[model samples]
Target chain A: MLKNLAAKAIVPVGLTVTGFVIVCSILLYSYVKQDLVADSIQREVLLGDIIVKATRFSMLTDQRESLRQTINDIGEQKGVEHVRIFNKKGVIMFSSNDEEVNQLVDMSAPGCIECHSGPVTAVHLGPMDQARNFVNAQGEPVLAITTPIYNEPNCSNGGCHFHAPDEKILGTLDIGMSQAPLLKSLATLRVRLVIFCLMVLVLTVGGVIALLQRNVLLPVRQLVYFADQVSRGNLEINEPEGTEELVSLAGNFKRLARRNLEADDSLRDLQDKLDTLTRQIREREIGHKSGN
Target chain B: MGFLRNVRRPPDTPNRAETAAAPGRERIRRLHRLAYRGLWGMAAFLALSLVAFNHGWLLPPISDGARAVLGKAPPTNLISIALVVYSFSALVLILSRMSTGQGKYKGWSHLAYLGAFYVFYHYGNALDANFWAVFAAGLTIMALEHYQMWTFCTEAIRKEEERLAQAERLEKFKS
Candidate 1:
């Protein structure tokens, strides 16, 4: 098998491989890049879903402690790394584990001076963290979620609970989730992807090699077999289906073999004819001498 | 190239002169030459990993910059694949150069084994049936391979020769 592959791949198989390598390298390069980004984005989206669900549940319940606790429980899931919550003011009201959220935070402001729209960290969301914003720190990503605490309407009825109207600005909540486990899982996925890519390249190239192996090896072997028959002065072999080029080649080889055979036969026949003539002439000469 | 080209002809045939002068010896020479070329091509392919997988620090730095930009590197995917690809291409280049002269041997079946190996190696870890299967298949090809070559070198000459004669005669009649 090795020899056959070696033989067949030596020709078109090898060339195909070279072309495939060049072509696939470029393709795989781009694919790998897109694959990485897509993968990270997918992970982030999954975590984001987790945060949204936790926040939504807390909003329905109307309890800060329960909301914060629920988010914490979900963050500590087998794959969840960290979780944190922020209020409408962008204050880190509650955190999974990071103690940096003890300071005052305000999210009512417009854009993030650093990562206003995405995962980048540079904007100030708190008075204490005005220098360094509430971004991901030490492999732990803090997802800022802002929720409003409404004042009871009955208190503003001038009877039971509230005092004024908009003065019921309760508190803010913040949540941060560690990205380590998620990143780690993604790393594993990347390894698997690499392996899968390797397999694909290998199998595809291998299949090509297998095809050429038989195509080149078999026909050439047939040509050789045909040649061997003619080489020994045997001129009765039919040409193998060596295609136009090989068929023509076989035709030439056969012609040469037959020509050599005919030339040798003709020369032998001529030698015999000369020997008989010489014998007859010598006999006649000897007889005349004896009679004289 | 020498080894592949060499294998296309038998050692005893040496050259066309010998082919004309002594056909028997010529056949032997061609056989040897073909074997030699095949061997040489393999030798070159085996040497590819030495350069591609050298792991030298200067071999070519991967894009740490891409990692920083994307927040993560591609996890050795590109480098490992580049290595495998380089090796496969080396195999192709060496073989093609050697076998250019062989029209019959220029087809694809002979190369099937290499491609199979590439696939096998890729999934060997995942599938767990890699080396053994490859070895078995390779050994099978080896067993059945030269059986035909020897037969070709010895027996088929006479039949082909007769066809060649008739062909030449027809050509002469046409002219």
Candidate 2:
């Protein structure tokens, strides 16, 4: 079967198609994965904003205990990694974990560097830039969103507040969520994509082989048989069937065979005539000799 | 056997050629019965592809089967399937014509397989089993045609070789 012409044609085609499917599937899966990651980050960013707003009243009223409780409650929620509110000086004023409160954080951290990476720290950053992804101390993937708190007029004008009106930024709200959900989604996507790719490859290649076997290989074998018989001078053989070209070729061969038969018939007729003429001449010679 | 036996040849006449050729004629007839059956098989496959492609009555089973095997929702866009079918069929038709020529075998023409793959990828969401089914059927048809043509040519060559060998033997005998 390997030596057959159909195999020679189909093996290369199947390989080429498999290569194409693998490459295209990988590229497509990567594209979809990137979108899912970005979407996950976007969701984290939105959640950060909502948490910041929920704690706004407590922060404005100087309710440090209430704000701390709110942050802790949010951190205890499912998939919530941590929630921290930091002062402009990078001091962790209120944190979900008590151990982290009052500790000074580095201004150039993954969650902070997006805004503080420049020569001067940025007063405001877009939601996308505010979101950052990293692995936490436990080696688990995390998506963190850093929302800067802008100084409002009420804060500076209030009796309990000492913030200057000129201060454009007050502090930052940083929240991190576990990336397990997003990773699970991505993993599922990858599996589905791979399965889909393999399925397509198999169907296409399998279909090709089936079609080739029926249309090409089987027909070729039959044509070879037809030719073998014809070559052995079997003009009474049936016409082989296949593709139009093969059928046409078979028709031509049949015509040629018929022509050969006609020529042979003509030869046989002339031979018979010669035999009859020879018999007549011999009989005449015998009669003439006898008469002499 | 029937025709040659009915001929009014002499009882002592040498029937060397007919005696040599008659053995395999029955086998050839049997093989051709299979070829005719294959013609019917091709027709059935073509009919299946058409049913698989159409959106009307018979599509659901084919589509569902494809989906179950695929492990996901298959693409259902008629326009994309139509485009792929059109382009792939046109390509095979051209290749078939090119293959019939006695010129150099264009191995490069097989690159069209890659092009078809790319087209599927470009319309990735629209690539489905129905499109592939149709495409595979057309390709198989063309490939079979080429295979038949190849066998026919080879058989002709073999016959010519035999003739040449016979002529050489006859010349030696005459000399």
Candidate 3:
């Protein structure tokens, strides 16, 4: 059923082109998503780190009220879910919300699990590792970054503070941001990619099919008609138009037919000569018999 | 009994052409059938797998190893690796084409293509997307190419058979 040139050539090529486009689109979409999400994570990590740095002086000077107010102000920004500083013991020393000032955070929580789940706490973590994604109580997606506040010589040697230098991590500055914008961007990207994929499929598949029809199928059909005419004893045929290869084949076919025609004409002439000779010989034999 | 005794017996041995062509023809036929079946199977699987994975109807086993490896490497690196492997696979396929026999050394080509699948799977895991799209595309190309080659062989064999039949007919006419 699929033995025709169009079916044999166009179908497979069209399908392969479509598949190729789809595969490429999937990979491209994936790469784009990865890049965008990675950028978002990096941005959140950088913001969290900057907030920690800004609050360092306030913490060193024992300005808890000022630090709390600063956290509250940062948290109040659009898309900023919450900002807080928690001590090493998981106690919320200062938070944007006053009611959660001294609350103990669960060590097993999504944001804390990266560092605290291991047998030994991980002091250093990559930006991706430090970032966590979760849905908050309000059922909105939030991305949180936890930056560790490392103890430095200045903090221990400062005149107002008396902390041992042996203490490595003092606390963690955790920041949560609503992921509405990122999600929205990703959703838009997905829709765009799907549309682009469909567009590519149609264009490529249609192009392939059209090319095959013109360059392959049309010429093949012409040749088939030419061959049928020749088979039905119609030696004269118009040259089929087609690709170079097919046109060359038609040329060869036409030449063969011409040769056959020439051969047939010569054979007919020879047959006529032989018939005349035989008739002349028979007449001569009859005359000889009658004259004798 | 006299009529049965007068019955002439034909030769039991097959002709050289038949013997030579029979096995090769059968092999090509089998390959063509496989290609046809595999093409449809790949198409169906690709569609179902993509939809299933996308809708979370079919969840792959939870494995973080692929995720970790994919996350650490940039997309460029992953793509580069896939491209290198794909080039190697394409070279193998070309070499197979250059060889005299159809479907020769196909196992090596298959093995080479499997390397590409590994990269696809890694990316899929990392992105939580369906890798079957890539896999099925590759399989479809391979199967189609095989089908085309085998079809050509089938046509050649059919022509050869016709020529042999013509010769046999001429031989019978001479007697």
Candidate 4:
């Protein structure tokens, strides 16, 4: 059964298409996942930058209540997990979560690891040291982006602020965004892609099989039956009709059968003539003998 | 026993040319059978080579320079075109036979086989499964036609030889 042409054709085609689908799925999933994560990180970073800008005046004026109110309001927006401002010493100066305010953040935490673990001093934090992923206490995946607030000349020169000429990094603003909605949408997209690939595969295989049956297998079967009949000395077989190849073959077979039949008829005619001639000669010889 | 009787009663004269040409005719018939067999052998070889080339088992050693000269299309396209040309030639041969009613061979049938081979070899990669199915069907038909032609030729030759022998004997008896 495996040696059959249909099996041979279908198996290889099916395998190749399946391999293509799997490879496409892997590549597409990775690409979409990467794109979604990158986009999410960019949005969160922009939000953190805006929050840092908004709270800069409050922080410099020593209005702790205003800074706390801004953080809480921003965190109430959809998809924002939390918004916090951590001082240079990794102390949570203000937080949307009231309990987290006035607490000391770990140096190894997602918001602090970028500047603390590296050889570079925390005072010279760059944009690359601002993003990390971690699971929140609620067990949801979160992307945190940190924006560093730099000490400006005005803050140091102004009469209300203390005299510090070289305070480059004042603090970091960390924004944590929930990734649940994005992941759910990605899962839905993946399911749709799988369904599309499967549909394509089924349609392609079905069309191939249908064409094969029509143009190849069915005609071939008819020709075989005709050939069998001819083999049994039944010269009265009808020619098969289908593709050009099969039609030509059946036509040739019919002609060959006719030729064989004609050859047999001619041979029979010759044998009959020879037998009659032999009998006439024998009878003539017998009459001649009797007369003598 | 038949040979003894004919020798004892040698009644008629024989055509000297017919007697002399008998062996030559027999040789010609043998050569014709050999030619058919050789044609089939060549066809089989071509079929196998086509299959091997299509499946990548047989790769022609073409250097990068040669490939550059040949362009990007697969070399099998050239082979398919050649086969198509050969099939056309076969078509002409078959037409000639039909007009003359001389040769018993089915050149058109061979043309069909070659055409199918061209299709399978040229477009098989794109068509995939349909290629194998069509190839199998075409090959089977070609094989059957070959057998039928072989049987027909053999039978016709045998019958002709028998008729000639009987006619010669009758002529001898009458004369």
TM-scores, all models, native as reference: 0.42, 0.60, 0.70, 0.58
Q: 1 or 4, which is superior by TM-score?
A: 4
The Cα error of candidate 4 at residue B130, in Å, is 34
What's the C-alpha lDDT at position B59 in model 1? 38
Cα lDDT, all candidates? 0.49, 0.67, 0.71, 0.67
Candidate that scores best on lDDT: 3
lDDT of 4 by residue, A172-289 (tens): 7888888899989998988987788788778778877988899889999999999889867787667888999899998888788888988999999999999999999999999999
| Full candidate order by DockQ, most accurate first | 3, 1, 2, 4
How far does residue A10 in candidate 4 sit from its true spot (Å)? 1.8
Query: Of 1 and 2, which scores higher on TM-score?
Result: 2
The TM-score of candidate 1 is 0.42
Query: Ten consecutive residues with minimal summed lDDT in candidate 1 chain B?
Result: B124-133
Distance (Å) between predicted and true CA of B115, model 1? 31
DockQ of each: 0.03, 0.02, 0.27, 0.02
lDDT tens per residue, model 1, B1-175: 6678657654673543333435544555675554444343344333322332232432344355744764643333453454355445444443444344321232134335444443334322211212222332222222222333333333345444554566556656766
Best by DockQ: 3
List of chain A TM-scores, every candidate: 0.54, 0.87, 0.79, 0.88
List the candidate numbers ranked by TM-score, top first. 3, 2, 4, 1
- Model 2 chain B worst lDDT run, 10 consecutive residues: B102-111
